[model samples]
Target chain A: MSRESIVNAALFALLIAVPLGALATDEPFIITLATRAVILALAAVGLNIALGIGGLVSLGHAAYFGIGGYAMGILAFHAQSYTPLFEGPFVIEGTKLMPIIWLVAICGGALAAFVIGLLSLRTTGVYFIMITLAFGQMFYFFTISWPAYGGEDGLSIYVRNSFPGLNTLVPIQFYAVCFVLLCAVLWFNARLARAPFGLALNAARQVPHRVEAIGLDPVRLKLVALVISGAVTGLAGALFADLNRFVSPTMFSWQMSGELMVFIILGGTGRLFGPVAGAMLFVLLEYLLGGISDYWLAFLGALLLLVVLYGRGGLVGIFAGKARNHD
Target chain B: MTEPVLSTHALTKRFGALVANEAVSLDLRPGEVHALIGPNGAGKSTLVGQICGAIKPDEGRVQFLGRDVTEQSTRTRARSGLGRTFQISALAMEDSVLQNVVLGAMGAAGTVWHFLRPAMKDLTIRQKAEQALERVGLSDLASLRTGEISHGQRRRLEVAVALTLSPKAFVMDEPMAGLGAEGTRELTALLDELRQEAPILLVEHDMDVVFSLADRITVLNYGRVIATGSTAEIRSDPEVRRAYLGEES
Candidate 1:
């Protein structure tokens, strides 16, 4: 195998082993934290497809993430309450199965991303960033006001969603599922990055006019990347909801979107495993700092500012040097 | 006689109160090099933009391959066989030289949506891209990052990208700008060789290269064509001499 393949494999194995080991210790705190890290890393990987490889600075990934979580929450509530989703010519009901909830979450997120991308891509640069953030805020406010599924109080699943063959109530099995999903998303992301669509997307970012001059439209390519990103992130959100057995408006906040970007930036933009490293560091710092002080987030904010200004490549650059290959 | 491959009629553009291009009319025939020369701020770039559909002319029409393209997007214009190179080489710096050429070919192929297909694995696209690089004498540097290549090589790569489209007409804006004598000589030879295949609308300031390579020359001053004639005629015309050639003389 090539050095790159070996390194990637080793990283993947390490990610799985670390979380599994933590769960084996029978410590609820550690298992919960590890699960959160794995889920957040998956979300970061999704954003990286667009932001890192495609060079799209979408500030609305939280909308998809939140939608995914809400799908799980709303479905579980209706399933437990024995209520139908809608009453009309045809009745729509909810299910508590993990796979079905994941599918609904991903599809919903992708659709939302498609609409947001269509409008945001009309402008470029900082305008695109702000527009995405605006859309995300709109979703956040809507979720906060909507009273059907617990509103601002949030919705609790009561019973965690089930997978086909495994006992998802077991922390280890649940963590394993999350781990497998994270790895799958990462693999898919890497494959997409090396594909022709990814090449055109990157080319559009670097020299859009040249891409156009060669007969490719930049806006269409970017929108496709955005949709893929949203779908992947939404899948992570479903996993997150299952992990917590709850979903809330906090999932759709700008802070969540900023954190996702931070994960990519911390690892190194456009580098595979960058999001994994960044997520681990971010969660670890939050855990350690929260134990010590109430103002830990302030410290994180300062640290992020420094990283953005000084350590532009993030931790991946520190260890791997500059990313020689495209993500 | 067959219609010209590309034509611009009464192309006029305004930026606020200033007229950047004023009723400029031009034509490009097949297998010929038409040079547009003028002093600084003569609206050559503006005309190029209008012709390539990057900017719409306020009061004129651009025709490509006998179809009106004045309202077409830049990508549509390119798909219709109008290829252009920028003044500053606009290559993807992070990608390899081979990848850059392949992107150009892929743009022409219109297969950018094949998300699962590896671009480098496509033998046909790679072959065409390599052939384009070879034509520009850049095959040896194919694996190198575009950022690492010499400025002159990047400029040549720009032309290679335009050539990869097998365009009916090539619109080059200052392809020789910032190149040394050796680089200029190399590009001049490449342009000469390309003239046998497709017509080139070259907007250049190098009078020496212009006089030697251009079959016909159009001189613009203050957004108006002051003279259009053979190189010999342009060089001797009293008005052309007084307006532009006087400075070089």
Candidate 2:
């Protein structure tokens, strides 16, 4: 195995061992923290599909994340309140099943991403970033204005959603759910990085005109990547909402989008488990530093500056040495 | 008297007030390198762009393989077997030399949408990429990072990428730019053999390579084709001399 692959394996092992160790110590809180890292990492993995592989640099991924959160919130709210989502059209019922909510979140996120991509993909570089940020802010305000599901204050779930055999209320069980999903996504990401689509997307990102000259549509590739990225992030948003048992407009905030980007940069862009490593560090820093002072974000800012200046590939790059490049 | 593989009829492009190309007609017959030569700012790039579907002509038709493709996208034209190389080295510098060719093969096969299967493991793409690399004599350097390759190798790599498309015609823009004498000689020899695979519409500034390799030559000036004839005829043409060759020789 290569050095990077070895590093990746060690990272996965450490992630798996964390919650297991927390469980042994009877610290359910640590398990919850691990779950938070896993979910955040999952969301970052979604963003990395566009940002790292596709070189989209989207600044508005929170739109998809918010959509996922709202999908879960609105459904669970209706299910608990014993109300129909739609009475006149066809009596659409709400579902508290985790699978159903996740599917809805994915579809919703994909649809939103498709529309946003259509408009934003027309522009590139910083303009693409601005347009996506605009779309994200648009979603944010739309949620705030439309108060049917509590709007800015957000929606609250009476209980956590259900799986077939697991009590998701247990911290370790929920962590397992998030952890398994993260692993599945990481696998999918690795496969995508080696796939023809991944090759085309990476080429498109580097030299769009070169890709076009070679008979591949760069914009179309980026659009597909954005849609897939959004869908995955949406799934994470649903899980996040479930963990908190609440959904709010804060999920769609620009800061949330920035945080997702931070995770990728911190771990390593394009690396399969970059988000996992980044999220682990982020959560750990938040917990450890938040205990000391309220100026934790300042410390993060300094660290990010250091990484951007000296750490070319972030934490994973430092561990794995030089980038693998073509892999 | 054989039909041209690619032809442009009175192609014109206007950038506001400046006429980049005006009523420029050209053709690339099978098994010939039809050189498009001009001094700097003679609209050679613009005319080439119109032929390659990168720039739309204000009023004209571009026929390829007996079909009118004036309205086609650059990618559509390329996938239909119109290969192209840029003046500057437009490569994925971060990728390995072999990966660049594989990307081209994948594009040629229209398999870029295949998301589950690994590209390297695909025998067809890998084989095609290897073949193209071998053709360019870049097989030994296939694993090297493209950015680290010699300037001449990058230009050959560009041709290798275009070759993966199995092109019926090539629209090469200044492929000889920035190459030394020895490098240019090697590339000229390679391009000579390439004409058997596909006719080339070559836009170049190197008169020696053009005089040596081109079967026919088209000279342009002020966005217009001043002369189109055999290389000897073009070399002696008075208007061609006055407009372009006057500065060179």
Candidate 3:
């Protein structure tokens, strides 16, 4: 087998082995941590589309994540209250099924990203980064002040949403669902990174002038990638909300967006499994450090600074040597 | 004849107090090689930029193939058969040489909407890109990454990219700028062959190549055309010598 295939197989084995070992132990803490890793990885994968391939440093991905969570929380609340979303021509109610909630979350996040991307893409460089961050803050503030869906106090999901042919409340089964979705998204992300749009997106990142010279509009291409990225992350957010059985204003915070970026950097930026590795390391560090001291975040910040300054390519790059320009 | 293929009328561009191009008017006939020569900062590159839609002329018209395309964007102009090679040799360095040519051809092919469809898999685009590489003697190095090629080879790749568009008119800015002696001969030969296929507006600094290759030459100094004539006439013109030729001494 080729080196890449061998590496992939080994990775796949580790993914199955580690999770299976966690399941065999029946330890709720380990299972829950594993589930969180998968969900957070999914979110990071979304940002990778824009950040890795498109070269768009969106400091506002948390906005989409929060939007996804809110979609789930708001729908569940309205459904529990037995109130229709709108009393006009059609009555839109919510469901407790995982797929339905995920769909709403993805669509909500994608729509918001499309609108934000349209405005943000008008500017480039630092302006684009700042505009996306501003838009994200706008959404966060709106959610905090809206007061309709528990506002600052947040909402509690009374029960874990059901999936077809499974008792989702069971920690193992729920972890399995999250694992499958994460794998599916990773597969999809891999395919997209090799696709034509992905090529154009990478080309735009390297030299936008060349992309434009080839008659492809860079703005439109980036916006499409951003929307797709936001949708994927948003779907993960819905699953996260269901997993935690709670959603709050903290979901929309810029700190969450920074954490998402940090996750990608920790694993390896632009590498296929970078987000996965990053998410695992991030959560493990948080868990370990949180146990040691309340000021763990300061340590994490110092570590990230050192990585950014010295280790440009994160852990995967260090282990794998240099990644070929795959895009 | 045939609407002159490409024409510019009193094209002027200014950056604050500096005039980059001052009412530069020129016409390129189909199947002709027109050379634009000037010393550094004589506005030859700026004129090429305006013609290629990279920069807008302040108060003039640019007509390409009978249409006034002065207001069009760079991509629009390229799609309409006006191709350009930058002086800096701007090829997609991450992509293979073949892929860069493929991208150029795909630009003219149609709107590339389907991302999943591999662009290189198209038989026609592949054939055209291969043909372009062959014309520039780069067929052997087609699969090499653009960044891996030698500087002269990259220059040829840039020309190959422009050729893949099957352009009616090519605006090449300093095609021989950084080429060594042997590389310059190869490029001169390539330009000679290209002149048979389409009109070329060659912005060049190499006098030997320009004098030998150009059917006509226009010399600009200080953003204005100082001389326009046959090679023999340009060589003998006292005013042209005083402005540019004497400076070389």
Candidate 4:
């Protein structure tokens, strides 16, 4: 195996062993922390596709992330209240089943991403970034103004959603579910990074006119990447809402989107597990620093500055050595 | 009686008041290098852009492989067998040479959309890209970072990129720019061989290489085609001598 793979393997082992050991010791709080790390990592992985490979610096991914959250929130809220989502010949009932919520979340996220990308993909660079940011703000304010699912207050779930053959109420069991989903996403991401689409997308990021001269449509490739990115982040959003047993308009906030981008850059922009490492560090920092002082964001900002300046590659560069240019 | 592999008729493009190309027409027939040459600000780049689909013409048509493709995108025209090389090396600087060539091979026929299997695992794209690299004598440098290669090698890589498209005609923009005498001679030999694979629409500033390789030459000045004829024919044209050939120091 390559040096990077060895590092990746070690990271995965540490992640697995820590949570399993916590489960044995009956530390529900530790398991919860692990779950939060995995979910945020999952969300960042989605963003990494567009940012790292497609070179799309989307500032509005939280639109999809929050759509996923709202999908779960609205579905579970209706299920708890025994209310139909819409009045029609066929009543649309809310569901507490995890699979159903996940489907709804993916669909919602993908649809939002498609629409946003359609309009935003026309412009590039800072314009693209601003348009995406505008979309996120649009969703954020729309959710805040709409009164249906608690408006700005947000909806609350009475219980965590159900999965087949598992008691999700148990913290470790729920963590296992999220962990498994994260692993699946990681696998899918690795496959994509090596695939033709990924290669074309990566090349397009570096040189779009070259890609076009070679007969591939760079915008089309980016659009597809955006939809997939949105779907994955949306899934993470659904899980986050379940973990909190609540979903708020704050899920759609711009800060939430910036935080996701932060995870990628903090860990390493292009590396597969960068988000995992970044999220772990971020959560730990938040907790450790919060205990010391409430001005933890200042510290995060400082660290981000350092990474951008000297530690250009983030945590992965420190561990795996420098990656070659293809990444 | 055969149709030209690539042809543009009365193609016109305007940027507000400046006419970049006006009633420009040219033909790239099979097995010949049709060189487009002019002084700076003479609109050669603009005319090439119109033929390559990078710049949309305000009026007239571009026919490629006997089809009217004036409205098609650069990508559409390319996938349909019109290839292009940029004036500046427009390579993915971070990728390996093989990966860069693979991009050229993979873009056509919708094979670029394959998202599950690794591209290297697929023998077809790898083999084809390698073959293109071999044609340009770049197979040995396949694993090298494209940015690290010498300028001559990068220009050859550009040719290799277009070669993978198996083009019926090629639009090469200043492929000979910035090359030394030796590099220019080596590339000229390569183009001599390449014209058999596809007719080339070469835009170049190097007069010697243009005279040696081009089967025919077209001179442009201020977005208008001043003359189109054999190399000997253009060398003797009075208007060409006054407008461009004399201006070349």
Off by over 4 Å in 4: A325-327, B247-249
The runs of at least 3 residues in candidate 2 whose Cα sits more than 4 Å from the true structure, single-residue gaps closed, are none
- Each candidate: how many clashes? 0, 0, 0, 0
Sort the candidates on TM-score, descending order.
2, 4, 1, 3
DockQ of each: 0.69, 0.83, 0.52, 0.73
Q: By descending lDDT, how would the candidates be arranged?
A: 2, 4, 1, 3
Chain B only, TM-score of each candidate: 0.98, 0.98, 0.96, 0.97
Query: B245 in model 2: Cα distance from truth in Å?
Result: 1.8
Model 3 lDDT per residue over A1-327, tens place = 444445556656766777678778867778888889889999999999889888899999999999999988988887777878777687788678788888989999899899999989999889988998898888888888988888888999898888999999998889899889988888777777665677667778877877777677888889999999999889988988988999998888899998999988977888778888788878888899999999998888888887778777776666666566431
Displacement of residue B218 (Cα, Å) in model 4 is 0.5
TM-score on alpha carbons, each prediction: 0.97, 0.98, 0.95, 0.98
Worst 10 residues of 1 chain A by lDDT: A318-327
DockQ of prediction 4? 0.73
Q: What are the clashing pairs of model 2? A: none
Candidate 2 per-residue lDDT, tens place, B1-249, comes to 999999999988999999988898888999999999988898998887888888888999999999999999999999999999999999999899999999999999988888888888899899999999999999999999998999999999999999999999999999999999999999999999999999999999998999999999998888888999999999889888888788466
lDDT of candidate model 4 versus the reference: 0.90
* Superior candidate under DockQ, 1 versus 4: 4
Q: After superposition, how far is residue B50 of candidate 1 from its true place, in Å?
A: 0.7
What C-alpha lDDT, on a 0 to 100 scale, does residue A259 get in candidate 2?
A: 98
